[model samples]
Target: MVIVFSFRKDPNALSPVNCWHLILSQCRQESRDHGALSEIYSNNITLRLSHINEDVARLSKKSKEIGVQMQEELLKVTGELQT
Candidate 1:
C-alpha cells in the first residue's frame, strides 16, 4: 500500500518561514514591554517600602521621647508627696 499527500497553495495561507518570523518579532516586542513594566513595578514597590520604614522610625522616636517625659513627671510628683 502507498499513501500520498497533497498540498494546495492558497493566498490566505502564510508560508511557514513568514509565519515564524512574524511570530518571533511580535514575541520580542512583548518581552521588551513586559521587562519595562516589571522594572517600573519594582521601583515603585521599593519607594513605598522606604517611605513606610521612614514613618515607622519617626513614630518610634516620638514614642520614646513621650515615655521619657512621662517618667520624669511621675518622679517629680512622687518626690513632692514623700516630703
Candidate 2:
C-alpha cells in the first residue's frame, strides 16, 4: 500500500533540502533519499536482501516441520478412533 502525507514547511526549522526531503520522502522508498544515495551500494543491498531470504527459508522449514508433526499426531488420533 502507498501512503500520502502533507506537511507544512517551516523556513526556520530545516534547510531547504531537509525540509523538502521530509515532504517528498513519503512518496517513495527512503533508499532513493539523498543520504542513502551516496552511502548505499548495490552489493550492500544484495547482501541484506540475501539475509532476509535466508530468514524466510529458515522459518519456512520450521513451519513445515511443525505441520508434519501435527499431521502425524492427527493420523494417530484417527487410527485410535477407527479401532
In model 2, the Cα lDDT at residue 65 comes to 100
Show model 2 residue runs off by greater than 4 Å.
Answer: 1-39
Taking the tens digit of each residue's C-alpha lDDT, what string does model 2 give over 1-83?
A: 99989888876788878878887877566656756755675668878999999999999999999999999999999999999
Q: Which candidate is the best by lDDT?
A: 1
Clash pairs, model 1 backbone: none
Query: Candidate 1's residue-wise lDDT over 17-59, tens digit each?
Result: 8799889999999999999999988999889999999999999
Per-model TM-score on C-alpha atoms: 0.55, 0.51
RMSD of each: 4.2, 16.2
